[model samples]
Target: MPGSTDEPTEPTPGKPSAADRAARVAAMRRTERARARRRRALVVAIPTVVVLGAAATVTAVLVNRPEPPSLDAVTTYEYAGGDHVSETVTYAENPPVGGQHDPVWLNCGVYDAPVRNENAVHSMEHGAVWITYRPDLPAEQVEELESAVAGETYTVLSPYPDLPSPVVLSAWNNQLAVESAADPRIDAFLAKFVQGAQTPEPGALCSNGVGTPTG
Candidate 1:
């Protein structure tokens, strides 16, 4: 039996070897981990891409939007107020543009009642725009004016019982009189002169002023 020449053969495999199985298991785990990493990357990347794209779109829209045209036809005056006088000062303009005015400025807001001219003049000195309309103006027109001035800082609105024009917009040393509330120049005037260059005190405070609304 020892002399028999047949080489001892390796065991015939019935199943995969332990080492092979272990290698396959490890490979599968590695593949699953790679897939999970890709998924996480995609989750993070997708939202970031969406947000960046949205921001870019908004920026483009803002950049492409048209700017308001400059208004040059507005009436100009030279009423720079360097003095704060307590006495009533008569101004050339019905609602004075700028002059010796009360120390306190009227708070900027819409008013159904008339605001005192003296206090409003002080607001103008502090770079406010005063919008005065005739008391007899239509309610609808008044509402239009109110919407225009609402939420705008350094702006005031009140009925001016008697006005040379139906509507008057006054800033420091500048005034614009419009015949109707629907006038297109109303917006132009405000855009040009609300806290505009003509203000004697360019950045003065318009809030916490002395006047209140009187209906």
Candidate 2:
């Protein structure tokens, strides 16, 4: 043993053993697997969170939306349309819901004077809501009706001679007579009947027709 060049074997410092390298590789693998699990969790969770947020938003909209008003008092009529006549046609209704209409539809807007019955009826055929009030109504009340139809293309506001009520909203065959300008039914009528289902000719041009409008 003394003559041999090889002496007692000694472990080298700053060198990893086979077991240590295997342990380090196993640890790294475990850490990588943990990271992969976390990434998968986030991938699954993000869409779930988005879906929950979207569902919550839809629920809030449904809950906060205003309920439709009751249209129990609205008077429905069965009037014939598309009857173009040249002469002044006498209608059974005071404001003339729908009957013989002029060939030209009156341009829809705010009118300070009494619009012709024949022309206005033609407008009604074209899905225009005619809001007529008595000529003698207070200026402020007249303003209220005008404001309701302001910037509206499908509405006609004018004065009618000897109207039965202070305010009368006529849409084709549908008519609603409200006593006061502040009546909620005025809005209700417009909501339900502006280019509504009962329209004889929906999407008809309310503009580019006859009569000069104040607005």
Query: Which pairs of residues collide in model 2?
Result: none
- Residue 157 in candidate 2, Cα distance off native in Å: 0.5
> lDDT of each model, Cα atoms only?
0.70, 0.76
| TM-score for each candidate, following the candidate numbering | 0.65, 0.70
Clashing residue pairs in candidate 1 are: none
Q: Which residue runs of candidate 2 sit more than 4 Å off their true CA positions? A: 1-64
lDDT of 2 by residue, 1-215 (tens): 77889878765564444344334434443434444466432222122235654653212221122333466777878988888999999889988999898999999998889989999999999888899999999987886676666556788999989888888889988888889876756666776677766788887899888889988
lDDT of 1 by residue, 38-136 (tens): 643222212223565465321222112222334465577776577787888776778778777887778887788888788898888877889999999
- As a whole number from 0 to 100, the lDDT of residue 187 in candidate 1 is 61
Off by over 4 Å in 1: 1-72, 213-215
Task: Provide the lDDT at 75 for model 2.
Answer: 80
Distance (Å) between predicted and true CA of 202, model 1? 2.1
